[model samples]
Target: MTTPATIPTAGDEKLPQAAKQSGQALQTAGRHTTQEILTFTIGKEAYGLDLLTVREIRAWTDVTPLPNTPPFVRGVINLRGAVVPIFDLRVRLGADATEPTNANVVIVVEIGDQLCGLLVDTVSDILALSDDAMQPVPATAADADHNFLSALATHEDRMVALIDVARLFNRGVPQVSEAA
Candidate 1:
């Protein structure tokens, strides 16, 4: 079983603290800002998110489906008592749905004040890249998937689409603010 000590959540400040200890320098000598990205796979394509926003990684677990939600929304999972909505990355990107397998993983992240989970095929690398290494998303590729990408970064000769977490979910992750 995975222990809490091994996994870092937003409540556990250890992650950012340890990261700061190692990456004390956020900027390079030439005034270039360095950013850390957590890359993962939806299918064959690669995607990434800001490392600072990632909370924890969980093995694929059965989620309780909700009614009247989009197909992309796989459902919600209770994480330490909080209901975190999980979205299937493949379906969200206009691809076929994913069949849950032992190899799948759920990446919990903070979209704002709420916590949400992104269901992905596999977790890849944690890359620290400079701002200049990232290229802006070309306007020509505008679409549902394209709109979600803020930048395209290359690492080890592979292009990783950096997702704009905030821009996803036009209505935001469904949070139960009050009794409906």
Candidate 2:
């Protein structure tokens, strides 16, 4: 039998003003309009990305290791004949890496013209949040790991870190060989 999909639990964080107003509008109209977000888990926290940007989610597959590659770069996988680099989300989040389990999933996403797979602990369900559900990233967030986040979304009690796909490979990380 196939495994059941995981869905994120809404938390208590307050929504941003814009999202609040939008939520209010939807509530009054008896309808809600929300953007679909593909949520996932990294370390102990929840994160999400725009579903439109996600191409596919695959189970953990054998990665072709590259010499001199950074530890976070789990290596590349032949995704339908096209080699796509995969990065371990745990390492990228400054967490200790763990062995992949049945719950692990590789989230393949396209940012601009570059395609990359994010190795996450598990794939959560698609979150549909009204405009008011999103919140602004705090100033302190700028001081955190540069590549750790790009945006923030609040749902009741939890804050979801929006991955910045473009900056996933920061300056400190070894660049993938163009010749590959």
Candidate 3:
């Protein structure tokens, strides 16, 4: 797996001067202003979210069924010590639901103070995108059953829908029962 580079900190006056120069160079190169996005796939389509909102990625696992909940909600999972609700992205995207396969993954994301898992087909790499590369979602795209998409990003000859995590869970999520 490719890992992000760690920035070295300044602990002395000389280091601070070098760090300031490097920071200015980065800013001049437009690196500090560009937003990084983490992309993933569901079926054949690509989607993205702000890299800052992504908590972690995990392999698909068995989720405990919740009773009297919407069909789109798969169930809840015990993540570490917390109970996290998992949503099936296929169902939420108006696609027919299917069983999880070896390639499936769960993308844990933070929406405000709430954490939830999004079950997707695969996890792709993080990408850096400039503000000019993003465009408003077309009317047809905005009319989808899913209301979380805020914009569409075109990068590296591919299209990625930008999801708004906060808007997705602005309303209280329905409680999932252990028995479904």
Q: Output the better candidate (1/2) by TM-score.
A: 1
Backbone clashes in model 3: 2
**How many residue-pair clashes does candidate 2 contain?**
8
CA lDDT of each prediction against the hidden true structure:
0.80, 0.73, 0.76
Please write out the lDDT profile of model 1 over residues 1-180, one tens digit for every residue: 876657544455433342354352264465556888999998789998989889999999999898888898998888887888999988888889999999999999887787888999999989898777789887775564458787899877799999877777655456643222
What would the per-residue lDDT of candidate 2 be over residues 12-78, giving only the tens digit for each residue? 4444443464232222233344667889988679998878779999999878887887778888987
Model 1, runs deviating above 4 Å: 1-25, 177-180
TM-score: model 1 vs. ground truth: 0.81
User: Any residue pairs clashing in model 3, and if so which?
Assistant: 66-177, 67-177
Residue 36 of model 3: what lDDT?
78
Give Cα distance to truth, residue 110, candidate 2, Å.
0.6
| Best candidate, TM-score | 1
What TM-score would each prediction reach against the true structure?
Answer: 0.81, 0.73, 0.76
- What is the C-alpha lDDT profile of model 3 across 56-153, one tens digit per residue? 99999999888877777888998777788998878877798858987899999986566789999998988887656778977775464566798898
* Cα lDDT over the full model 3: 0.76
